[model samples]
Target: MPFTLVLPDGIQYVGLAFVSTIWLQIGQAVLVMSARKTAGIAYPRLYAEKAEEEASFLARKFNCTQRAHQNTLEQLPAIYTATVLSALKYPVFAASALGLWVIGRILYTSGYMTGEPQKRNTRGGFIGSLCTFALTCTGTYSIISLALAAA
Candidate 1:
C-alpha cells in the first residue's frame, strides 16, 4: 500500500516486541510461580507431610502433573529467542509467532499430562508449534531478505 502506516515500521516493531515480551513474562510467571502456588493450595496435606521440598516432591510424584509445568519451563528459551529475532525482522509475524508459541506451550502442557505428547497437541498444539516454527524460520530468512534487498 504505502511506505509508512502512520508510524515508522521500526518503531512499530520495537513496540510490538515490548508487548510480546510482557506476555512472555506473564507466561513465565505462571509456569514458574503460579503453578507452584496452585500445587501448594491443591495439596495441603502433601505440604504438611513433607514440608521440605513438598512442592518439588509432589510435582515429581504426580504423573502428568509435573510434566506439564516442566514442559512450559522447557519451552521458554526457544520461544523467547524466536520472538526476539522475529520482532526485529518482522513485527506482524513476530506477534503471530509469539501467539503461536503461547498456544503451542499451553497445548504442550496439556499433552504432557495426557501421557500422549503427540495426542494432546492434535488441535491447537500442533498448529501453534507449526506457527512458532514457521515464525522462527521466517525471522531467520527475513534477515537474509533484508540484506539481499539492501544489496
Candidate 2:
C-alpha cells in the first residue's frame, strides 16, 4: 500500500513561505544525508563532460552553478518577508503565498533537475518569487499605514 506523504517528513508548516524554508532546510540535510546528490547538483565538477546534458549544461558549460545555488538561496528572503508580513497585514494571504511558493520551488527544483530550466516547468517558482515580493510589499505598506493612522 502507498503511504500518504508527509509534509516535512510528517508535519506541515501551514500555508506560508515556511514550506520553502522547510525545503531549503531539507536541502541542507541532504548535504549530509544525501551528500552525493546535493553536491552533484550544487557543484557540477564535469562541465565539459556533460555540456550536452540539460541539468549540468548550465552549471558546467556556462559556469552558473553559483546561479543554481542562488536560486535555492533566494527561497528564504520571500519566506521571511511572508512570515513577517503575514504577522502584520493579512496573515492569511501571506500564509497562502508562502505555501504556493514552496510548492512552486519544489516544482522548480525538480524540473531543473530533469528538464530544461527555461521551460514552463519552473514558471511556478518565478511566480512564487513574485508572490513573495508582493506579499512583502503589501505588509510593509500596511505597517506604514498603521503607523500613519496612529500618528
Candidate 3:
C-alpha cells in the first residue's frame, strides 16, 4: 500500500519536500534490497567480499546499486539540512528543488541498475547532486550570514 500525504496551506510545499525525501530514502532501500537479492548477499560480510566480483553480472549490478546508495547517504545529511532551512525561509523553492532531486535520484537508480554508467556523469544523478550542492551551499551561507549579522 502506498502512503498518502495532505498538508495545510502554510506548510504545503515543505510537506511535499518532506514526503519526497522519505520517498527517496525508501527508493534507495529498495535498490539495496534488489542488489542483495541479485547477488545472494544476505550477509554484510559476504556482500563486502562478493561485491568486488565485478566480473559477475549480479555482483556488478549490486556494486553499482550499493555505490549509488552510498553516494546518496553521503549527500542526504546536507540535503535534509538545506531542505529544512529552505522550508523555513522559502517553502516553494525548496520543495521544487527537493522534488527535482528526488526525480533525479529515481533516474539515477534506474540507470545504475540497468548498467548505465554514464547516468552518473551525464545524466540524472549528476544533475541531482548539483541541486543538492546548490541547496547546501545556499542554506549554509544563509545561516552563516544571519548568524554574523546577529553577532
TM-score (all chains, Cα) for each model: 0.55, 0.58, 0.77
Model 2 weakest 10-residue run by lDDT: 5-14
- Which residue pairs overlap in candidate 1's backbone? none
Q: State candidate 1's TM-score.
A: 0.55
Q: 13-82, model 2: which lDDT tens digit per residue?
A: 3343465567755763453234234335444442323533445443332323323345667657656755
Q: Global lDDT for candidate 1?
A: 0.57
Ordered from best to worst lDDT, the candidate numbers read 3, 1, 2
Candidate 1 on 7-115: residue-level lDDT in tens?
A: 3265465556546555644664455344456445364332222443444543433334354555555766776676666666676777766665666655655555443
TM-score of 3: 0.77
In candidate 3, stretches whose alpha carbon ends up further than 4 angstroms from where it belongs are 1-10, 46-52, 148-151
Tell me how many clashing residue pairs each candidate has: 0, 3, 0
CA deviation > 4 Å runs, candidate 2: 1-20, 27-69, 120-123
lDDT per residue for candidate 3 within 12-44, as digits (tens), equals 876877788787888888888878887776666
Error of 2 at 14 (Å): 6.5
lDDT of 2 at 63: 25
Output the better candidate (1/2) by lDDT.
1
Instruction: Return the TM-score for candidate 2, rounded to 2 decimals.
Output: 0.58
